[model samples]
Target: MLRTSECNSEQNVNADGYRLITNENKPPDIKYSKENSWVAGVQMFVSFLLAGFGMVAASLLLDLVQHWDVFKQVSEVYILVPALLGLKGNLEMTLASRLSTNAHLGHLETSLGTLIIGNLCLIQCQAILVGFLAAMAAVAMGWIPYGEFDIHHALLLCASSVLTASFASLVLGLIMIGVIVISRKLYINPDNIATPIAASLGDLTTLALLSWIASLLYSSIGTSVILPSIIIIVGASLVPVCGYIAWKNKFTKQALDEGWVPVVSAMVISSAGGLILDYTVSKYKGVAVFQLVINGIGGNMVAVHASRLSTSLHTGQKENSVLGKTTKLLLLMVIPGQLIFLYTIGYLRAGHTSLTPVFILVYMSAALLQVFLLLSISHYMVLWMWKLGMDPDNSAIPYLTALGDLLGTAFLGAAFIVLDVIGDKDSDLGD
Candidate 1:
């Protein structure tokens, strides 16, 4: 959109000719470009606020939705949930990451509009493909475990997933384009801000869409399969059409070829995390309330780290280790940032006060550990991906954020187990 206006509009067009105001004529603001500890801290803190709130809302909605007849009748959606949600990291956040990297490398200056449109289309195409595959995986997981496969349920998951993903990607892609363009214009680092914002918003919107669509489809299942069948077929039909268009675009062409492994792999990884979520929530219901917050925060932060390092690699900045300035600062940020949300979680949710000093200690350790390990992984992962001639923006985030989800979810479950063990010990001693 900006391409038609800002990219071409002449500053002085009142006379016989127009004057182009080039980047050479307009210098970037000194304040916005220079990121010190304070600026980075402020950005990270503000982002964490939005991230925490959005995830809490998504988690609450999920808790409510799971009780509905749709989810209860067909449990396969549980298997699909994390896999689809992971695409927020895989498709949408990766788009943000790619846009941020392009912005930093001055590609935006040359063709911001084309970059935005191409990347947005690419993400939508990816969302369709991955969403379809994730649905299949969910259907298989739901069937193989029970030895009772329902083609009706299978079709529902596929339709719900493809439609939700396509809709969510279109919505989130627009938001990403707006966020990246505005961040660049404001001299803020899109890398620092874009991925988390996309991710946080993606979780909320995608969850809402998925629940609503699934419920609608579930209600109609007894009467007709026509609706669901049309959805899957049409969605399948678009794959090649969108794929061809994305392949034609220079900004997204190479990405079409090399990034499938990470997306599909990340989906499988997140499914395991989702399985853990199911088990943990069954034993400790409180786990669902905060799992989204803790696990989401971990993934959001690491996704940011991944996005930044990817931008760095694209800019020709050699990153030899994970112990650099940003790495250390981000690592230190995990404790304070996570504690604020943990406190908020305690304050807002009822009867869920696992905020005992002992529990807090365990949770904080998990938060810090999740972030630290993910940062280290992203650091080297991005570098290695870049060296092997694959685009890190496309490949690295899916894996890192998926791993972040797995680690964060597992550690949270572990924290609950630890709290239980200590409580049992205290009771024995008291008795």
Candidate 2:
């Protein structure tokens, strides 16, 4: 079910169904270089700042619109939010990670033209299919459990999810290319820089676009169904056209054939988080606001960890000596960085929580556990995938980021539940 083909490269799939690209990778593995701890600290901290702004912006936007009819009426928009955002991690960040690995391997110097075109085309094709599937998945997840299905609601969710995914992928894909290209020119590792920027903007762009598009389409509902229906049809139609272009390119056909287990499986995992969000949002007053920031921060930090491990593996450094230092640096930033965001949320105009001692303890506990586990997994995953003949660049990121979302969402939800329980017990004591 997995295959990767490159010129002069021998490829075979393992019994576990992962593809191994062998012996003849055209670019030589560069020896691992010592990264200055100071340079890495600054790079990741700056990236985290940008991500904080983005997460805050997304939180504000979601807060501003949660009472709006589009959210109230569709309900599945909550489902779409995480699913669509996860698509960015799955599709765009993966593209950035692959391109980063290629840049390190010197492919950009040797085969820039074909690699760029084929990669850009490949993601577009993926975005179309996965976007629509995410939409359908959102609709099904939102409705089937409750046995409540509305045609109009289904149509709106699909249209908005497609529009958000298509347009966001296009825009983010270009931005990621620019980020990676600039990183190469500056002699900065794209792994330390690109993925966090992608994650930051990914949440910001998808949330803004989804809200705007859903709002625009929602206004026409009951009055007219023309817009949503056309989007559903056109978005559905693009899958094949994009697929054909991607399939015809010798560079991309292998990935096209590789199909969607990683991305789709990631989507399904995020939907479980979405269901958690839906179930708890009303009961836990500010959980939705914290969800985007918690999930984005956890995912963003771990993505940096995963991308670094992938790059190190590609450079043929199997020892933890170098990687251990990198992990410590990344984790050091993660603890304090998340603390800033949590307090920043308290300062936000709406969806503000008291930031009580217990909540901080509980919330930080969850975030810490999520990142630690993900960081631990990243090193092993890249090594395991590489040994299995699978390209970790293409495979590891989506799963890591998606799992980050699930853990962030689940733990954040639990934090709020715990906070409420203690408050109730205190009320009884007061009486």
Candidate 3:
């Protein structure tokens, strides 16, 4: 029996020159033993770089906030924004985690039958259920305007979330499968590429879908009681029906059993962050872009940690043993990424007229604090879930990303406040 520790080492040369098997069930042909940790880390970082671009693109959604009357009038849209963005990222990350695990285990079959369809069902089901829940939760949290938490608000949230999630999942699911296949062909580990790629695509596609669909639904028939009512009833009804199917279907059972708790918890947490973001968006110009970029990069870092740890756990590595390596690697990778985010955002948003040293210091300080907190949280969370016999893949990304959003928003807001206070002090000194 090959021990898991040896799997991490360079491939061994046995007496007959046969490679050691990573899994007893799968042959050596399927396992990526030679890829090593550094290779995997580099691949993940590259994928993350690409994911960064997708995240940056999500800033376009903020343009709607600046320009569209509908988005401007509906405070609920801000509530919907974080939840929807987080939802898309959460679902895709989860899906990619699942697929990566499948690829790692050599269980990824030649035909995309059971694996693909079951996961799709799971993604769509969660999208529908979570979408409705997110809207309701937003209302409960009072993220809506004074008079806007009515039937129309509920209908718009439910309809947009459900419809957009369903559409996005289907499209994103196909894209992930293609990515996995290509990675295998290219001798790259799918585990390294799939999650970030899927996550990036999820952010870009879902934001576009949610914005267009919500606006389309609201504008054409918003005033009519019948349209929103139909959306509410039908969408609400599908949740349980989908739940029942997920319970019965073998393909989707793992997702149903394991996927919900974390994703829903994340959505609720993200909605809290959304509340903060919505309140502060107008007060701080260019913060919307900051929120999207920080959350995206922060969340992707968590996913990387989670995916790497999940693969480790699945391959029989001890949780504690892998934790240090993951942490060190995460620190190395996340620092440069965060630096890139801070410089790009600071320069693009603040540099046109004048870039102050105080502003730069505050931005770096706040952003670093967020990243430090996130990395520490992710390390412990993955280990804790593993110790508890829960799957980290199912729990980690959702919780971490949501919390990342919450903390990222808070940190960014606090930075702005610091900048304001210091600016005031400087003015007084001059006088």
Say which candidate scores most in lDDT. Answer: 1
State how far residue 132 of model 2 sits from its true place (Å): 1.5
Steric clash pairs (candidate 1):
none
lDDT of 3 by residue, 1-431 (tens): 11234223233434533232254444354347555778878988899888887876776456444446556755677777888778755787877776776676665653257667666767777887788788787666653355434666666767777777677877987888788877876778776788778767878788888788777776854567676567667866766776776566554575688777888888988888888887777666556666777777777777777777777666655345433765677667766876665566445552111235676567667766776688778778776776665666666788888888888888877876676666621221101
Q: Judged by lDDT against the true structure, how good is candidate 1? A: 0.77
Candidate 2 residues 307-353, lDDT tens each? 77776655545445434877788778767887888777667535746
**Higher-TM-score candidate of 2 and 3:** 2
lDDT of 1 by residue, 138-256 (tens): 88877877899887898889999999999999999999889988898888888788888987898889889999999999888867889999998898888788788877777787777
What are the runs in model 2 whose C-alpha is more than 4 Å off? 1-32, 321-323, 424-431
Error of 3 at 115 (Å): 0.7
In TM-score terms, candidate 3 sits at 0.85
Candidate 2 global lDDT: 0.77
